[model samples]
Target: MKKDIQIPEVSNVYVSVVNEYNDIYKTHDWNAYIINDKDVALEMVLIVTRGFSEIKSTSTMRHKLDMLPAKSYAKIEFMQEDVLALNNEFKVTFFEANKMFEKTYLFRKNTINKKALQTIPLMEVRGVLVK
Candidate 1:
């Protein structure tokens, strides 16, 4: 019976971290975003995120969106400077066409930095992308 269960593959959805400038604070900060590149809208979008290291772990954060329109993106959260030292993980789950799909995107410790910036899909700025 275990073999009979089929898990759907996730595609066209991505988690990206972009370094953005805060005009009000005159500072640069990193922010996480969820990109939905599918042709159809996703329903009941949910994302659980956290950062961890061998010696310590951050608290889990949960975010939900009733719908994520096709070919769009949403900001998940702001990343503090300290969290960059830890492995960051984002678990995304949503439904499309009555089928459930889930995917985990991870940025390994110290992987998110200026040198890794690149043009990301659906977002105008350059940032680090985890597939």
Candidate 2:
């Protein structure tokens, strides 16, 4: 016999798994929002996407060091506000699935194009998916 687990309804939520390096793994984009004056940080509706690689996290933190063997996948939820915040603060956001985040760094106001948003690549990402 096989067990049937019901995946939560996340039509309006965006989810991305981050590794120990803070890289983004698999990500799902949805039409979600954060209600005003809500105790809950944000309400996310999970959206469905095809051809997404499902990965897991395989890293640990001990004392002040993080031992990460390789890049894996995990489930993560990102609110709309979080996305806006990342865009505003960091100027560049990661849209790749199952990529190590450690190799990516966000520069606030440091780049050749200081007027526009710039991203410094520490590592090559597998790919980036939007929507």
Candidate 3:
């Protein structure tokens, strides 16, 4: 029997999955970030429900997180040898302070964007030594 899983259409937090390559290790790295904009702490968990009856984590997929500080963010990074594992279905359940906990599903078909560690470029003063 096929299960019915719904992907969330909206969420209070912004989630972005970045595909990174480490030249040193010569392996692919995946990072997921959960950004909370509200003025409240949040508890989150990534749920992967693909080729299974319910949401679960396998050797290929894992979920990690607890509480995100108010107006702050949390990040989860993992290394996977299989690129296809990155496409697995995912969702997050957050405990909203003084409110009921909620779940948001993430629907990703392909690789997302590359994470820009430096949003703004830092300029260097060439040959300038401040005494």
Candidate 4:
């Protein structure tokens, strides 16, 4: 069995999230864009956690990129209701650098009274892991 690992931080990679709503069409849109701003190519594994109350859910994505071509973005989109959890977590690993990053956000605390459509940069991380 492999032991669970904890990694150190590697900066420059970013996760940008935007929320969109359509009142007339009754649609909810949540977009997550992972940006790699480094000069080297990256292999990444991403995980996101969402839920409310006792129930929880997770979504994962993995990709091998050609350096993200410098300042380009790869995006994933999901419905807003899917992330109803007050506390949301994002984990990303850069295979090329052998670094891992984790971040958690409290939706109710941060966006309770904010506009429905908003963009936030998840810069500060909760934990980091390295090989």
What does the lDDT come to for candidate 1? 0.95
Task: Write down the lDDT of every candidate, Cα atoms only.
Answer: 0.95, 0.22, 0.46, 0.47
User: Could you tell me the lDDT of residue 97 within candidate 4?
Assistant: 57
Best by lDDT: 1
User: For model 1, where is the 10-residue window of minimal lDDT?
Assistant: 4-13
Model 4 Cα lDDT, one tens digit per residue, 1-131 = 24567655656666555544557678745555566666765655444544444455455434343444445556644536445434344455556555554444334423322244333333232211111
Residue-level error in angstroms, candidate 1, position 97: 0.6
Q: Clashes in each model (backbone N, CA, C under 3 Å)?
A: 0, 15, 0, 7
| Per-residue lDDT of 106 in model 4 | 31
By summed lDDT, which 10 consecutive residues of candidate 4 come out lowest?
122-131
Q: Quick one: best TM-score, which candidate? A: 1
If ranked by lDDT, best first, what sequence of candidates would result? 1, 4, 3, 2
Which regions of candidate 4 are displaced past 4 Å? 1-6, 20-28, 52-69, 82-85, 97-131
Model 4: pairs clashing at backbone N, Cα or C within 3 Å: 6-129, 7-128, 7-129, 7-130, 8-129, 8-130, 51-85
Off by over 4 Å in 2: 1-71, 85-102, 107-131
Task: Estimate, for each residue in 35-124, the C-alpha lDDT of model 2 and write its tens digit.
Answer: 112122221212222211123221221111122112322222232323332221111112123221211112121121213322212222
